[model samples]
Structure formats: structure tokens, C-alpha cells
Target: MNIEKLDLKSPDLVNENFEKLATLFPNCVTEGAEGKAIDFDLLKQELSHAVVEGNKERYRLEWPGKREAIVTANLPTTKTLRPVREDSVDFDNTENLYIEGDNLEVLKLLQESYLGKIKIIYIDPPYNTGKDFVYKDNFSKDAQEELIDSGQKDEYNQRLIANPETAGRYHSDWLSMMYPRLKLARNLLTDDGVIFISIDDNEVHHLRKVCDEILGEYNFVAQFIHKNNSNKNQANLVSVSCEYFLCYSRDLEVLNKEIWRIEKKGAKDIVKAFNQLKKQGLELDEVLDEIKDLYKRPKYAHLSRWNKIDEKGVFMDDNLSREGGAKDYTIINPDTGKPCPIPPRGWAKSKVELEKLREDNMIYFGDPSTPPRIKSYLTGEDLSVPDSFWYIDNSIDTRWQKQTFNSLIFENPKPLELIRLIMEMSSAKDSIILDFFSGSATSAHATFQLNTEDLGKRKFIQVQLPEFTNEKSEAYKAGYKNICEIGKERIRRAAKKIKEETKADIDYGFRVYRLDSSNMQDVYYKPQDYDQNNLDLFGDNVKSDRTADDLLAQVMLDWGLPLSLKIEQIDVSGKKVFKVAENSLYACFDSGIDEDFAKAIAQDEPLRIVFKDNGFKNDTAKTNVKQLLKQLSPETEMKVI
Candidate 1:
């Protein structure tokens, strides 16, 4: 009986791609020195109907390090995420996650657990304005070390390099950095998923081409223009007062065409006010007068036409005439007991539909003289398709951020309304939203606000690198030594404010995890390099300073389980056991494991189980435990670290 050891690494995407291609074209697969490899010559012939040409010229977006970027994305990582209990809000119960690390490594670790699970992704990456720094992926460590030796990188290991305009590879470096991260992000989206990227004029054209290549040009949705600032008078050429959001869908055909609508501006406030007046038992005349007065306010003035009310609700008189003259129909007015005049063009609805509308009290006639108009109820006609242009004041967001933290800790934080608008139009009530470039956690803040408004179950996953703050900046002075500190604090403040103001019963907590080296010792991965002289040196495979919680997290990642699942600690026969998601998995890292504890745990019949390699009292005890589980709980799949 063989007990398998868990592989503590991410999925090798290159091997998986080869296997997929082999399944599709068996004749094009051949065994190579490394293993099964694709014969590109034969594969090209198989895909083309005509004779294929070698090194044919084609239109493509490429840069100096494009190939290396592709290779980086296909490679697997040996890193793991260690939970930070002291920094987390509610570690055991919350589904939201806040991860701190290099986003490239973080995205690779999340490939298996969150594949095709996220519904919406919004990122506000560095705009590459020649002053801001871009992520240095360290494709070649020698090059990175050279940069560090030259004083390019700070001593804190921020993994960022400034791309000045004078640099030879200004655009190339930025493109290479964004390529692999976008490629990895695409794998985490569902069929109907969409991504929105906030960019500026500095690199919008290049970024658009990169997205078109990765997400396919046919899936391009729209380029929304946001007039965020209107007072930029310091431009040498032209005053650029706006930025852009490039939107793309994973599969355009899978999205519902009608789902891109949002409630009209100020519609919710109008409904709330109307409902309040009616609940007070005001007379119909008094209610109409009060509603008219409410619409006179500057905020609700645009919807003044919907001032009339009836037993159903507030409504506006809409023209019943069709533009091109549809079926003509007339009906008698109930108030005047006479037939109303017909519209010149014709009624929009057919005779049968018109009769149904009259029965439902959806038509209004004035004294039987004017043509009858349809009554468009506010409740039924409140939604409208969002436009491609948005005009929002930037100072409002700055003021709100100041109020939230009681200080301007972060610079140029994304507006909460902008993220909330994107989420409202793209996501569902119970969707998972991800922001890999979450600088100040605005995406998570938006998720909490939206869920509070509708009592939704939306969850968010925020990923950011712990870049050091400038010593002269206000954030550094406020004791926020890194960007991650500001982000986590902003989330806590936002959640508290929303809960206190609305008394919302939603998930107001998040679990914090930081990227680190794997829990396994070097010998566990490279046993072939050791000889008999040093064989006994590694009595245990796990590192000395690592804890059981670290081991459990890596095990969950290796087994393709989400880190947000519930975990329960159990004590049985003087040993500790972990039960995850009830019966989905069971793990025990305790020593002195015997047949009695195995029998006790086997009775639960968990689908999967894991144990430490040296946790048993003796070799005989380990063998006996395996055999006992095979007989007692035959369905349970067991493994060891």
C-alpha cells in the first residue's frame, strides 16, 4: 500500500496546456526529453486548410521581453499564503479575503481555488506616467541583483523600478509587467465575467492593444470616459481632464444583454420619500403637493415629471403615439364616459394589448379631449442602460476619504462611487469581485456598500503588494509604513462607518493573508540531492518555526480548496484534529497517533484526510493506521505532508 505525499507547488500551466493540446490532436504530440511536447509544424498544418508557410509575417503586438513574460506566466511557484490572525478582523467566519504580496505570485497561487469563480474584476494599476514605478517581475535574478546593486531598488525589497521617459525600454517594461498578470487574471473569471481597467492618456493605447491580444478583440465591451478632474490647468500641451476605463468580457455571448442597466439617478430617493409620505396617512391632495415640492429640490429636479401619484404609485404621463404609426386604437375614458381622441401617428400597442392595459389601469385620459397617454410607473420604469460618459466631481471622493480616516493617508485613492457603479452594472447579488491592484481597498469598500443596500451576499478578494511608503509622505508620518497597512485600515474604517449608519447585517470582516516561502523544508522537495551521510539530518519535512496552521493552509492549497472555508479544531484522545467544511476534509498534525484515534476519526468518514509524516509513534503504527482506515472508512482518500 503506497501513501502518497502531497505536492506543495502551484499547478504547472505549461504541462496542462500540452495535455490539452494532446487530447485535441493526438497526431501532433511527440515525446521529448522533458516529456510530451507539441510538434508545432504538424499542429500548424492540422489547423490550416492550405499549405503552411514558415515564419510568415503577421500583425501582432510584441515587445523585447514578450517571450520571457509568457514563460513567467506558465511557470509554477513554490510560495504559500500564511494567515495573519493578529491583523485579521474576523478570521474564522468571514468569507472576504485581503492578500498582501507580489500580485504575480499571488495570482498564480489562486489559480486552482478561484478558477472561473469571479464575476467581476476592477483594477486601477500604475498609469506609467514616467514618475510612478512599475512592478519588476524578476524574470532573471542576475538582472534584478544588478539593478539592486546600482541603487535602483530600495533595501525593503519593494520589487518596483521607476520607468523614466529617458529609459530605452519605457513602454516595453510596462507592457511586460502587465502581460502575465492579465493572462493569469483571465483564468479566474467565469464565462460571463468582465474586467474594467482604469487608465490614463499616458499608456492607454498600449494597454488597449495588450488587452485586445489577451482577451480577444471581439470581447471588447466599451471604453468609458470619466471626467474626474476639470481644473488641470498646468498642462504644457493640452489640459487633459478625463481618464478612461477599458472594459472586456471573458465571453461576450454568454452575458445577458439586458443586465447592463442600473437604477436611474435619484430614483431610489424619490421612492423613499414617496413611501414615507404615504405611510403617514396623508390625503391624496396633500401627498401630491408634497411630492411636487420634493421634486423641486436640486437633486430631484430632473425627475419632476413623475410628481403625480395614485393607488399603485408615482407615475408620469408618457405619449402613447408610435413614431412610425403602429396599429391605431381608441378606448372610452372611464372618468368622462366618452371615447377619447386618437393620436395622430397611432397607438404604440395593438388593440388586444391596449384593452389589457386599460384593464390593468395603466392608461390616463384627460377630460376625453386629449389623446390617452400611458401611465409609466416609477417602480416599473426606474432602470436605464448606463452611458459611456460619466461626470463626477473628484473633490467629493477626496473629502470622503479624509472623513473616513480622519487624515489624508493615501494619495489619489479611487473614488468609491466609481467602483460601486461598475459593480452595480456588471455583477449579480451573490457574485465574487476581485481587485488584484487594490491600492487602498476601494473595491472591497464598494462591495460592502452595495451589499448593505440590497442585503446581498457579494464577496470580495483584494490583492496588493506591501510597497514601502515614502518617508516624507503623510501616510508614513501617520505610522503606515507600507501600502498594505493603509489598505487594511481603510477597509476597517469603511466597514465600521457603513454598519453604524445603516445597521446592515452583512459580512463586515475580512481574513488577512500574507505571501511567504513554503512550509516544507528544502530536503522535502530535493531528496535526490541528499546522501546517506545527511539522510538523518532532516528528521521532519516541515520547517522548524512553522506552526500547524501554516501546514494546514498549504495542504488546503495543494488540494485545490479555497482558504475562505470554515475550519473547526477538534480534540480527540489527547491529539488535535482539524475538520474543514464539516466533512469535506480532516487533518491531524499531532504526534503519537495510534489506532484508537484513527478509529475514532474514521467513524466520521470524511471525504479526504491528511496526516503528518512523522506523527506516528513508530513505523508499525503508521502502517497499521493506513490499513485500519482502508477497512473502516474505505471511501476516505488519505495522504501525508
Candidate 2:
């Protein structure tokens, strides 16, 4: 039971998010009469032509609850993540996290620690095809009121149900749900980070427009066509077998600077050609000649473009003319003894640069009737650039996903290879990937799979609300109560399988945390209202229901420390003392703590310390403890509750 002292006051998310924005663009931040506020005029100036101002028929996304959604994103929650040790794989050491909660509130909670830290975000949100559940966030209602008003009961006490097409705010409700989540998600992305959102035709356009507004229109990358559900049996009117993945970058300029590309298939063919040529007992030059000749075959016709064979190997000719802008110039053909006809976009290189190409025999002049082209060698490097079209190959498809769960526990779970490709293309070896809408935990499974394949150390943070499964559904019959249960099991199964198969040193583990009300009691919030008679009762403000471990977890969260860190308990002069992050913080919540206990803790010189105010028997004892700490660990900041 890792319950902590409840804190009623929520973390100020709006202010925190504003501070981050101010850090990025200080000129755009200005002081309001009341407090810090954004100067829209200055912000517009900073963005230059990118700013969309004035309501003069400009293109933008609109919905009934758009303003409320923005407010919901800015609104803070008094919720905290309590560790569920039994459900977790590695309770203390894993970098991966599986959070069960409303993702909007969770995103706000994560803003401070995870801001600008995530490398890739891949979310398969509800498609809002009139049957999917649209998150209803009663932004104006407090936690308890929200639960009672929504008529939801169970752990976490939130309502989730499918929104049918018959609802009046069909599209608006869906938009409202997504707007805040996307807005907060952008704050978590690194400058070069990218996001991939999977959606169907139903709301793809709305999703694009919302993303454009939140992530900036300039960052739009591509809408990739994934041919996953291509079976015509499921199509109603047209055989709509393909879905879309709308990719966007946090900053296009930053992503462009990296020059990213996905590795192409057909490397096996290149390897096969090399081996076949070797078997023919041909010399190196002869092998090159044979390979070049083989490329002309109809089966391998795509390779025919590399027609020239030289010391640099099989080479292709590229037109010498520049692309787009033209730089006109004339040059003698040398052999022809006359200048060749200039291309419309003139030569790309100057006379001196062209002379270097000629000297190195990199200019192809075999076609004397035409302008010479620069020679480009085709080495073993068979690279292909990623385009909007993503045709289905054996590696990508949902068949394996359905087979893994065995009961269609989740509909249309993404293929592991599909997500792996996104991670490989967009993230570094040690990147951190996030998926708030992590149905069936496919993103988590894929991340682990990629790590095993490349021996990389990628990590993931998965967030999903515990939406209840139908009582008569396959998942419920299998003893799973909610969607989160199924998602967790999938990850557990994936981890065990990967470990058994690879037998390699990998982090196939995750910590599970459930979002709930803070552990502090109600009296802790309105202490000023209490008279001296109740002062003694309020002395122990920590909730009686919360355990010492719970309070420690809350302190760690309030301090912005990772919740998965190892916690150590030690006995100090007959009292229990807690140490976290290897002496980074120490706390003694037990009562009857004497000067000896305080002295023992202070002697360790921990960086930060916390104690219960009534732990001491009297003021004299407390004063002695403070004096001891002041002398032994003067730098250790102390707090009392």
C-alpha cells in the first residue's frame, strides 16, 4: 500500500507551462497588472508572418468546447500517482512507466519533469467514428463532484463510454477531448521531436487541423497511408483498407537539420546478387561488369539506372543543371570543340568546380550529343527515402497483433513493426517515447522489440485510463476488469516473451502508478479555519489512511523526483527513517522521535530532510533536534508537516 499524505492544492499547471514558454521566448512574455501574462502583439512579432491574427475569415479549427478544452489543459489537478507495487514488473529500477489515469490531467502533472524531454510520441487516439468513447472532462467540477455528477463509481471514479453519432455534440465532444491532450503533448516534445497520430477517415481532417494549430502548421511532415485493414470484407461502401498516420515535428527546422530517412527494403536482393557473382569465380572488375549486366534484367530493372561501371563501381548519371533557381553558364565540350546547349536551369557548378569533376573522371561524357552529367556511384548503400505512401509488407499488418491477444481484446491494434519503424526513423538509440492513448500497450511492446533487435536502450512512458471492459466481453471473461488491465497484461506477456527469446540484458520491466487524490487529509488545506481546541487534532495533518510509504511518494512527486526510484528504510535510534534516491532526501514520519533520532539522521548529512512536527515529545526536544541538525547538516533544507 504505497499511499501518501494527501495534498489538496493542485500543482499550478498554467503558470508552469507559461514559465517554459517564457524561457523559450522571453520577449513575448510581459508582466500583467495582476501577474505574468503573454504580450500577444510581441508574440505575433516574434512569429512574423506565421502568426494568424484578426478574425477576417482565416483558416482555423473551431468547435463548441474548444475554449473549455484549452482551459482544461491549463487547469491543474490535485491528483497524484501512487505506486502499485504488485502490478508492477520492476517496482524500483525500471525507466519505463505505465500510468493508469485521465491522460489530460496526467499530461499536466508530467509537464514540469518531462517537458522538452520526449523524443517521439505515437498515439492511436479514439477515431471518433460515432462509436468510440469521447473523454468528458468536466473542467469546472472538482474531483469528488466530477465523479458524483458523472454517476461513476469504482477505483479512480471517472466516466468513460462510447459517444454515438446520435449525440448533439458528436464532433465537438471529440474535438474537445483531443484539443487539450494534443496541446499538453506538444510541451513534452523536444525541439527535434516528432509525433505520429493514427486516425481513420472519420476525423482525420479535424485531427490534422487541431494538430496544425497546436504544433504549428510549418511543422506538418506527412500523412502516411498505412494499408493495415485492407480486407474488403470489412468495408461498407468502398474498400477502405487504409488508415493515416499524421506526422508532425516540434520544429521543422530542427528536424530538417537532422536529415532523417528510413532504411529501405530489398537489401537481401543486393546481398544475393553479390553472392551469386562471387560463386561465378569472377574477378572484382568482372563481378562489377556481371552485376551491372544483371541489373538490366527485367526482374531487377530498377537497378538499371546505375549503368556505368568504373573504379568507383556501378554509377548513375545525374543532370548537371541546378534545381529550381537557375545560374546560367556556358562551357566547351572539349571533345566537340564547342559549347553545349545550356539547360533551362543552367549548370549547377561553376567552371572551377566542373573542372575538378572532369579531372577526377566524375563527369560522364560518353553521350557527346548532350550536356555531361555528374557520376553517382551505387555502392552497397541501398537507401530509400520515406514518402507519404506506406504499402503493406509482411513486416507490417495487424494479423500478428490479433493473434497475440487471442480474443480481439482490442480492435485494430497497431502492428509492432509499424511503430518500430516510426521509432527508428524519428528517434535516437536512447530516445524516450510516449503514448498517452496506449491501447493494448502496443507502443510499449514495440519499443521493447526494437531494443532487443538493435541492442538499443530506448525507454517508454505509457498512459491509459482504466476504461471498464464490457461485462460479457472476452476481456472481462478472461478476468480483466478494465482496458488498463488488458494493456498491462499485454506488456507483461511481451516482456516475458522477449526475455525468453533473446536472453539478453534488457529492461523488459515497467513501474505501474495509478492516479488518485493526494494522500493529505482535508484538514490539511484549511488549517487557518481551525481554533486552538482543534489545533492538537490537526497537528497530525497527514491522512490516517495513508501509510508512511504513501507520504514519501507524495514528497517525491512534489519534489519532482522520478516515482520509480528505489526507497530505503533504516532504523535510527528505535525509530523508522526513510531514505530516497540514495540519501538525496530523508524523512521520519513516526511520532515520539527524540533528539537522538534527529542527531542520527543529521549525522548522515542528507541533502534534504522532512519530519513530523508532533514527532517530538515537547518543544524543548524539537528545539534540540533542530539545533543538532543545524550544526551537523547545515545545508540540508528541512520541512515539517
Overall lDDT per candidate, in order of appearance: 0.85, 0.79
Residue-by-residue lDDT tens digits, candidate 2, 526-557? 75677877677666766677777677767777
Backbone clashes in model 2, listed as residue pairs? 3-550, 4-550, 4-551, 5-519, 5-520, 6-518, 6-519, 6-520
TM-score of 1: 0.78
Clash number for candidate 2: 8
Misplaced by over 4 Å in model 1 are: 1-57, 142-157, 229-233, 268-346, 350-381, 524-536
TM-score per candidate, in order?
0.78, 0.74
Error of 1 at 485 (Å): 0.4
RMSD of each: 13.3, 13.0
**Candidate 2 versus the native: TM-score?**
0.74
